[model samples]
Target: MDYEFGMLAWSMAGHDKDKLYVIIKTEGEYVYLSDGRLKPVERPKKKKWKHIQVRKTIPEELCSLTEETIKNEEIRKVIRRFSNV
Candidate 1:
């Protein structure tokens, strides 16, 4: 059940914490929040055709790093806590 997903990170609107997104591969080349499909840049003269890339969301529950959720903390904590060996 291993699949690749994109890491789309941004600040949540009106919220202090960073927001991460995860979307199914089948959804393909789309931002979870944006209505338009995520397309790669191409020259104006060339026809647009390429592999679709997508932004995947990471669950919110796993977002906290420190013993308590500290404001404006470095992401190093989160990385150390959850990163693969």
Candidate 2:
């Protein structure tokens, strides 16, 4: 699956398994993710593509946002809504 910016990703493997994160950026075989609080946008967590399940669902709030325009608060809101936390 093509991992796009603003998409939500599910960590399928590794120590962070089952955690939800917003995609901040995508590289060759990796994606940068952030959960707002734990992994802030300023310093996103880098993970391998094979390790995550990209949801490819961009929340309405993040749909219009770019990698640069997105905020931590917005990321947190979307994550909270989806994760039901």
Candidate 3:
């Protein structure tokens, strides 16, 4: 499955198993993920495609953020807020 930017996904393997994360970037079989906490935007987690379970894709406008506008605090807040809903 093709994963879009800002898509929600769950870790299926490794030490961070079962943790929720947002897809920040993707390339080939790897994807850059951030839970906004453990995996902040500046230090995203690199996981394999087959190791994640995609939950759903949030609205593009809501998740779509330019590199210049992407802040760590905002990313944390958004992930926390949406997950709590």
Candidate 4:
């Protein structure tokens, strides 16, 4: 299944038909800078982010599937060995 990610910037209401909640830096990790350490807060009822940006997607080749496959194979081998022991 295809999954998507976005930052919930703010909540808005009673706007034009084309506008709704503001979602920013969608679909990938984005570098966000804050003046101080920010923690999760209650959802605001206003539109804080006016910028709609798309984040860069990393190439799948960099995340080598070979390592994961090897790990899974090793796990299966260990499970089979213990099962027969």
Candidate 5:
């Protein structure tokens, strides 16, 4: 699957398994993810593409964010809205 920015994904390995995260950036075989709380947008967690199960839902607001404009609060809101957490 082609990973893109703003896409939601679930961590499938490690301690973060089943936790929701957003795809902030992608590089080669790795993707930067943020849950908006523990792993905020400012400091995204880098994991392999195979480690995250991509979700079909993409937050339209996030798609317009640039690196400089991405905010942790907004990311959190999006996750909470979708995951109902």
Candidate 6:
């Protein structure tokens, strides 16, 4: 899977399994994820790509985020919107 910034994914192997997160950064086979609550944008969880299941839904708000922009609240809102569905 080709990981890009702002992509929504779910942790599949760790204690956070089934929890939603947004891809903040990607390095090789590892991707940094943030839930915007437990794991804020300032401190992302680095997990292997194989451990995350990419979601088809990509929030529109994600497109506005950049490496310099930190929008933890938006990330949290997007996750809440999808997880409820």
Instruction: Please name the candidate that would achieve the greatest lDDT relative to the true structure.
Output: 2
Error of 4 at 32 (Å): 31
* Residue pairs with clashing backbones, model 3: none
The global C-alpha lDDT for each of the candidates, from Candidate 1 onward, is 0.27, 0.92, 0.78, 0.25, 0.88, 0.87
Q: Worst lDDT window (10 residues) for model 3?
A: 59-68
Number of the top TM-score candidate: 2
Candidate 5 lDDT by residue in tens digits, 36-66: 8999888899999999999776778787787
Query: Which residue runs does candidate 4 get wrong by more than 4 Å?
Result: 1-70
- lDDT tens digits by residue: candidate 3, 1-85: 7986777788999998877788888899999988778788888999999999986767454465864466667667666766776
lDDT of 1 by residue, 1-85 (tens): 1223223333344332333222222233322221112211111111111222223444353344321332212233333333332
| Runs with alpha carbons beyond 4 Å of true place in candidate 1 | 1-55, 59-74
Residue 84 in model 3: shift from native, Å?
Answer: 3.8
CA lDDT, candidate 3, residue 33: 89
lDDT of 2 by residue, 22-73 (tens): 9999999999999999899999999999999877668889988898899999
What does candidate 6's lDDT look like per residue over 1-85, in tens digits? 7888888998999788898899999999999999999899899999999999997556788787785695888898888998998
For model 5, the superposed segments whose C-alpha errors exceed 4 Å read none
**Model 6, residue pairs in steric clash:** none
Q: In model 3, which runs have C-alpha deviations exceeding 4 angstroms? A: 59-61
Identify the runs in model 6 with alpha carbons over 4 angstroms from their true place.
none
- RMSD, model 3, all Cα superposed? 2.1
Model 3: how far residue 55 lies from native, Å: 2.3
